[model samples]
Target: MPRRHRLTPEKHLKHAPWRFTATDKAVLTRLAQYRYLKSLTLQKLTGRPIATVNYSLRKLFDRRLIDKPHRQVEGFNHLNAPDIYEINARGRRWLTEEVPEVTTLSRTHTEGPPKHFAHSVAICDALAEIELEVATAGNAFIPAATILAKATVPNPLKMPCTIEHTFPNGKHERLETFIIPDGVYGVRYPDGRSELVFLEVERCNPRNPQTLFRASLLRKTLSYRALREAETARCLGKKSFGVRFIGLSDR
Candidate 1:
């Protein structure tokens, strides 16, 4: 398969309202059957170039009518290639209610019946922009962190570090990697600087209320001692990071 493009962060606009076309619905239905199909394969099925396939998928994804499958495959360059397209319960219901012609196959239903599937789709669109932004930033590629800290003083880790937050729940969600937004200026320690000097400017606005709330609860519920102990045992897993919240009034 040809190299598929990675999405950037500017595209994660979940709070926005959008509409999907009939073509978007068709592409999604095809993807729902395969759970993951390459743009080339989609072209063969739809009789178009890989570009059209991606465009349709992007629209469907932006609309939240389909999701990328959670599985990975070996790529041409030995990287983890994405394959399959699985429609979640939300997508199924949307198809049934909004576009009922293709409900032949029964679909499973989840608790939050995705009344805002269209909204989630908008978020996915924003995430594509975010992914593209990160891919191009080239701000000192740092090794994936095993733990989070303010900053590493004395350069103990001896590895390059990046300052950014992360969102882990994309269509093909990856591991605990930071989702560094574009326009976030990063400063690095010179060869002789004592402290690890750095600066950052927030860019992407995170609008997912549930994830933000859950992360906050987790931080408070897990005490310092308990968190440390769990880290020592390698039992506590890292959740995705989000935009840092400064003081703001709920009005």
Candidate 2:
């Protein structure tokens, strides 16, 4: 396999100052939304060619507007995975200052890649695929932001519920837990009807013992069940909602 060309500050400076374009702004916006994304993912989200996306990323990196987490270098290089990028303070400031209309929340800036980097990336990939498909179907994809803006409940994403379970000794217990999903989105059909859905990405870990994994799954199932019984969808101004789990392999 051919080696990938590294972008150095010296090489970046040799060219004229990179002017921000629409595509560059789109890349920053996406970084703000996803927090961390792969170079290929950005290409798909921006609907730009890979070369163009790389060019924009390089320029943004040179300007200190975006970052490549050092942790990704070794693992991604070995696997030939696309480079992961994140927005930095400067990038968020640029979005707020230059593109006043763009929303740049404090969460946009991250210290580094998440502990579960692969899992996070999988969630982003699933959301992107769904968004693209919804657009293709001529339906409007309502993102979490819109849902939150219209929600009557505070922090609806992090729902709290009580779970009841029995021990081997036949003792019953009630535990308080939270049902936090990976994401929330809605699909507005052309017929003026909308469907709200919660997303959960589940990845099986071979290292985890089956018993432990099953217990974890059970807790999640119970949490969702509790939420359904409580009619938590009403908090979001909906009578009902659906939970979609995207199962992933350990690979």
Candidate 3:
């Protein structure tokens, strides 16, 4: 009797159930990472043609794989506005099975008004653009897909430092808690160097500049400095990470 040879997955590809194309899965993984995207944004992320992106999105929607989040902005035309979408429950489950590398994202919920929903998606879209820039520039980029949701600064053993805020009248109070940052990812330069970026995208549009000063940018900076200080003290000759900030204007 002749010995039997093992069959390969490609050899059995014709008999297998339909699966998303590599592009589709890549786009889905990004959707899973970002939690929301519009068709235009999806095209940007996937580097696919606009028509292809739109058609694939429609197919995903038809299959109940993604959800369209509604916005409450007045005079907001859904057609004109970028439609917000996320992997629905079914989509999540499918991705977990197909792409085990992705740790499932927590279902994004909205406690704010629908307008805030629009802002959230806009912020994500902006970050996606930065990632596109890095990729197009021939640098290595790591999307949030592989990044954990929360990261502790100065490691688990050390406590984050806080500064005191002194008022003009001489009343001084300790600054409030530090933030964990919006996201962190690695970027490798073509020169073979890489750094983990502390990512923050300001989605808030101030009706005035006062709103900007009111936010915690200064305090956030100081907090990060403290983390760097802690690292310096804790380790020797280690390079430090930097913050990359991006802000969008209402106009």
Candidate 4:
């Protein structure tokens, strides 16, 4: 078998003022997925040390490729939380020019409280894990498009609502719609069978059986059921996709 051609900065890009390394290319490729990532997340995704990741990230930050959310202040009560980093316009352009493996470039920025910050980090972490796992096994892996409510693509998912009717047959009709998950992607196995997956990252700790039945988890399950039972999407030629929600929970 021929050797796999791993992407290298020198091979694809011109190294002038500052040199880009394998780790740098890896960072850019992963950021191609729409999400904000911190140094710890990058360390985990790239298998590099915290210092090394920080060094590379700082360089990228200096070059105007990445920036922390303007609102996040690294101070007391928020320990071990890496600075949230998102690719900027320059970063997007550089990735598009330097990396052929990166087909698209999208910007993801974060600006909010720390808990909310943690939630998004958890989401990126989950996606990064899947990307690594599938690629390691040589299976075909497609990263999901980032779900942004404000983005251009129209989202079909809607919040649960009640509709009133004037007729005596019924007082009202409960309108239900599926929830757009944190991420969505497809995976094709070697046997030609494939699966579309929906990922939900719950940063909160696991709840008890009783408590779990009413909150976000319950709503998510109902939405998944609605989508699957109703043929929300079709795959291949005849088979419709049944989304399986992979929940990533962290303390």
Candidate 5:
């Protein structure tokens, strides 16, 4: 049986940059389907090497589009069990909002001598909503109007609702506060698939230290989560998934 997702509108993860790339879109699409993955899976899926996949994974984490879920079987060689990977809310949004809409020659057309950079606000807004959808995973149903309503409001910080968790045996080992709003959405990637992606938008500084630091933290957290979730599901014989991050820069 296929997996089902649950999304909410509350603010769980950070935002994706304005300028996401084509490769980035492909990666995100992969995650939207699987939810989690391993580096070897990605290499096989995308026909890339482990080094390239690792590098892209780092970049995606920095942009905050993906997160880790838990670990799973690692190597096919029987060397030992390796870690599993999962996708987060951000990656889902990119897949639905950005990737499928892309035409094969659109990139070349845009960069051709004619020079057509038709970046539309509607498109951006759509992407944002898609991102928001991924952030919520498949838990809830969120409408674009609701997001616009919140975005229009002046920093109210009021999501439709919120949820608090007490997972003593979980990794956080404490009461966790997860903002659960009505319009949240999130995406997951296939385990060890190359479709996982990273997107980054550079509107200001090409190298923002602060953003980078937060992104790193988010990635680590996401990776750990994917691994844990996978193990739990495997042990319990339940459907498992993972999360991957993508970064986008508009600059």
Candidate 6:
């Protein structure tokens, strides 16, 4: 068997222009939505075979439309971890120019992967799974961008409000907090009914004491309770909405 020569970005630039396919555009769109995604996640989101996803990713990388940071290799277990990719400036421009329907593009990660890369990856995994399940159930999963398009309030996702609590000490306490969800989406059923949902990804760290975790979660719960009481969704142009929490383990 003959060995295949791996082409670098420079070599690809010198070669003849490569045309875009449906799969290629789909991959780019996903990148634009998530900002950072693993190769396997792209496969799941696109519902394509591993070979097809890898080929598309390779071609995109070679053309400098996407970036696979070396920092990913340093952070994860290299033996089995999939490559992480992000859309570069060129890719963003390509999508804006070539795909007119793609109006929303995630902000570029100028500082590289976030401080909590695992948490981000877990969020993407959960989203991919939920999206697939929604499709299987014959429903449409509308992403945050779509939901925000019709929003009346500015920056509704990061909501800020005040909460008042009556403590056991017979005293009234007021706390001001922000309700920032990891993601917001909507599920539309066949009966012309739609439900809005806020997604929060929680990770359990073995190093942190359980008591602290519980306290943190309690605060979040209170914040969400306040949000519901205030009918934040209605303010955001929705009748009602639900909050979903996805728990992840450090292991």
C-alpha TM-score for every candidate: 0.33, 0.81, 0.70, 0.63, 0.30, 0.81
Q: Where does candidate 4 stray beyond 4 Å?
A: 1-16, 44-52, 70-83, 100-116, 145-173, 203-215, 235-251
For model 2, state the Cα shift of residue 230 in Å: 0.9
lDDT of 1 by residue, 110-175 (tens): 434344343333233233233234445533312112122223443222222222223465422112
Residue-level lDDT tens digits of model 2 in 1-251: 65534533323453466678988999999888777778888998899999999999988887778877766664566256787888888788888776776532222235655777777767877887788789999999888777777778767778998887665666666778787788788999999999998887787633222332233656776778889899887888787888887773444
- The runs of at least 3 residues in candidate 6 whose Cα sits more than 4 Å from the true structure, single-residue gaps closed, are 1-16, 103-115, 164-173, 204-215, 248-251
**How many residue pairs collide in each prediction?**
25, 0, 0, 0, 80, 0
Per-residue lDDT over 36-117 for candidate 6, one digit per residue giving the tens place of the 0 to 100 score: 7888888988888999999998888878888876656656865577878878888988888878776342222453557767
Clash pairs detected, candidate 6: none
Best by lDDT: 2
| C-alpha lDDT of candidate 1 relative to the true structure | 0.37
Regarding TM-score, does 1 or 6 come out ahead? 6
Q: Tell me the TM-score of model 3.
A: 0.70
Candidate 6 differs from the real structure by a C-alpha RMSD in angstroms, to one decimal, of: 4.2
Task: Give per-model CA RMSD.
Answer: 19.1, 4.2, 10.9, 10.1, 20.7, 4.2
Off by over 4 Å in 2: 1-16, 74-79, 103-115, 165-174, 205-215, 248-251
lDDT of the structure predicted as candidate 5? 0.37
Q: Relative to the unseen true structure, what is the C-alpha lDDT of residue 65 in candidate 4, on a scale of 0 to 100? A: 72
Q: Candidate 5 lDDT, tens digit per residue, 69-89?
A: 321212133235323344455
lDDT of each: 0.37, 0.75, 0.60, 0.56, 0.37, 0.73
